[model samples]
Target chain A: MTEILFYSLSIIAIATSLLMIFHKNAMYSVLFLLACFFSIAGLFVMLNAQFLAVVHIIVYAGAIMVLFLYVIMFLNMSTPITIRKSKLVMFAAVLTGLMMAFLLVVSVWQTQAFGQHPEIVDQNIGLAKTLGKVLFNEYLIPFELTSILFISSMVGVVIFNKKEVEDE
Target chain B: MNELINLKDQLRIIPLEHYVFLCIILFSIGVMGVLLRRNMIIVFLSIELMLNSINLLAVTFSVYHNDASGQAFVFFVMVVAAAEVAVGLAMLVLIFRNIKSVDINALNHLKW
Candidate 1:
């Protein structure tokens, strides 16, 4: 059952991402990306990262996607007019990405024996309270610093929008 | 609770190789989008895809090793990603306002 679920979810994730790449309309592409994000959340759940799975949906599909849609709409960008790079550039991009993917596949296949075989993960690892403990205990410095980073980003946003403040 | 463990056991039946390959393929798609697309928003979206793929890989290993630290790091990745996309889109908005377009190719004024 898990195998079937993993296979289907992965296929959904891959297909939606492909649609995002090929869609000419930015809105449609964004929508496809949202589907891809949700499918990834499902994969996370399968991986026993239940907390990350929920947070993934809340952050990526819920908050970030809304922001993406808002910006795309606000800008009112229509279909891009084929910002035509040469065929060589397109071929190069495809070739390089495919080469990287092939390399990754070959390496992953060869290195499978190095790691111990998979087993049942601990339930405590994936829940919020368990992660909360680790976050506050082992990762306290980075946890606190994330807040500082968040604050700086907020300030950066305000600074960037300063022109609009002046205009209004 | 026993049933849940059974499910987790079943999850392990799917080889880790499949997970790694899936992530790499998705990551490659992201790379392709970033390299080929001229639209800044799509490029940003592709970047998020790449990050998501990495987060997936991290969580996979975390679970396979019976560890929690990797999942915690995934949370951090999401937080930083949110901040990045927010600031990046805001800057994109400012650029659009000035140049009246979002095509990245249009921003060549800095070139002498």
Candidate 2:
């Protein structure tokens, strides 16, 4: 049953992700991206990472995609009819993508080592408490730094947005 | 045939590899979108797709090892993603205001 569920959701995710890439219409691509995110979140649930599943839905599906949609809608931009009007840009994009993919494959092939973790947690264990304890205890500084990073990013956005307005 | 089914069953039993492979495919698709798409918003959506793919892998590894730490990392990822979206959308809006288009090609004006 779990296998079936995993395969089904995985298929959904892959399919929508493909659509997200290939769709000519930007809005349709965003919508497909949302579907892909939702399906991945569902997969997270099947993996027994309930906390991750919930957060995935809220963050990607609920917040990020919506923000993309809002910006697209506010901008009222149309999809570019010719994606590759310039041969140079097209070649660059394809070459970069291929190079990155090659690098990723080589790295994965080279570093196939995985840590041997004892399966003590199990599917029944709730992740939130354990995650919180470790995050606040062991990885405290990094966690706080991440928060600061977010705050600075927010400020940067405000400054940029304000600058754009002033220029107008 | 019987042995094949037994092996298939064993392989398909946990579906660990299936999740990982699916995530890889999804991540590549997202990468292709980010690379090939001209629209900035769609590119951003593709980035979110890539992030979600990583999140899927993280959860899968967490479950495979029965560790809660992976899921916890996913939580921080989500927090960062939310903040990222907020900032990204605002920037997109500003960019749109200046250029009236969200095409990546147009972003070259600031390349200097």
Candidate 3:
């Protein structure tokens, strides 16, 4: 059952991600990207990461996607004529992909013997309570710093837009 | 026949390998998107895909270990992802306003 679910969700995730890249319209691409993000969030749920799944939907689908759509609308970008990559860059990208694949294979092979095989994921472990304890206990500093980071980003956005308005 | 039945029963459980495989597929798609697309926003979207793929893996491991800490980290990641998209898209908007396009290939003015 989980295997079937994994494959089906994987197909949706991959297909939407492809559409996101190939779509000519920036609006359409972002929309497809939202679908991709949501499908990934579904995969998270199947992995018993329900908290992350919710956060994925809230953050990526809700917040990030909206920002992208707003930028698209604000720019009022007409359909892109063409977005091209240079041959040299394309070659480099392919080479990098192959190298990364090789490295991944090597690392997995090296670590295979040392690591214990993982069991079935725990299903009853997710909900907010467990997450809260861990966040407030082990990862307290990073949690606090994430807020500071978000505030700085908000400040940056204001500064950038303000500069734009001033120039105009 | 009993052994076969027991084996089938065990197979019904969701294994960690399936999650790992899904993560690999998503990560590859993201890599392809980042490498092939010239639009900066799409590139960022692809980056998000890659991040989400890793998050999926993290969550899978967390569950396998019966620990919630991994999910907690994912929350932080999502927060950063939101901030990243906000700032990234804003920059893209400013760029489009000035240049009248979102193609990264045309960004040669800052190449000095």
Candidate 4:
């Protein structure tokens, strides 16, 4: 049963990701990418990280994709038509993807998958409570630092995206 | 529920190598998008895809090790990804304001 769930969701992820790439319209790409996120979230759930799954949907499919669509619309009021790359460039990109895939898989596969894990996950380490404890305890410093990063990035956005009409 | 526990047991039946391969393919596809696509937004999205692929690997390892640190890192990844989109889109807006197109090729010359 889990196998069925895993394979199906992976297929959905793969298909949507490809469509996200091949689609010319930026809007279509955004929409397809949303599908990809949803499937990835499903995978997360299957992996027993339910909290991260919900967070994934909220952040990626909800917030980030909306931002992408907004930017796409804001950039050009009309529909966005992507300019095609040269055939040679396209071939090179495919070749690079293939080569990188081969190298990464061969190297990683050589390493044993991981340390011994119980056959059954049997624990709720993925639960929000467990994760929160870790975040607020051992990783408290990095957790606080993340907030600083968020603030700086917000300020950077405001500065960079300030409308220019006021300057005129 | 008993069924839920049983389902998790089924998950254990699957080995970790399968996930590694899946992530490898997904990450490669992301790299393909980043290399092949010219639109700045698509490139940004591709970068997100790559990040997601890495997050999958991280979470998988965490699950295998029964550690919460991996999940904590996932939180950080999400935070960073969010901040990046905010600033990146802002830059995109600024670029569009200065030059009317979002095509990376058109913006190639530094003077423009």
**Highest TM-score, which number?**
1
lDDT by residue for model 1 (A1-168), tens: 677778999999999999898788888889999999999999887766788889999999899999999998888785554634788888888888899999988888888473566455576688889899998999999999999998999999999899687987
lDDT of 1 by residue, B6-81 (tens): 5467554777778889999999999999988888889999999999999999988787777889988988999999
Q: What's the C-alpha lDDT at position B77 in model 2?
A: 76
List, residue by residue over A1-168, the lDDT tens digit for candidate 4. Answer: 677778898899888888888788888988988998898888888778899999999999889999998877776643656546588888999899999999988887788646344665636888899999999999999989999999999988877655565665
Better of 1 and 3 by lDDT: 1
Cα lDDT for residue A112, model 3? 53
| lDDT comparing candidate 1 with the true structure | 0.87
- Select the stronger candidate by TM-score from 2 and 4: 4
TM of each candidate vs. truth: 0.94, 0.81, 0.85, 0.93
Per model, kept true contacts as a fraction are 0.69, 0.57, 0.62, 0.68
Instruction: Please give me the DockQ of candidate 3 compared with the native complex.
Output: 0.46
What is the lDDT for A137 in model 4? 96
Interface RMSD of each: 1.8, 4.7, 4.1, 1.9
On DockQ, the leading prediction is: 1
Return the interface RMSD of model 1. 1.8
Each candidate's DockQ: 0.68, 0.41, 0.46, 0.67
Ranking by DockQ: 1, 4, 3, 2
| Candidate 1 ranges with C-alpha deviation above 4 Å | A80-85, A113-115, A118-120, A164-168, B1-8
Question: Using alpha carbons, what is the TM-score of model 4?
Answer: 0.93
**What is the C-alpha interface RMSD of model 4?**
1.9
Write candidate 4's Cα lDDT for B1-112 as tens digits: 4554454575557778778888998899999998888788889988998899889989888887778899999989999999999988888888788888777887867865
Candidate 2 clashing pairs? none
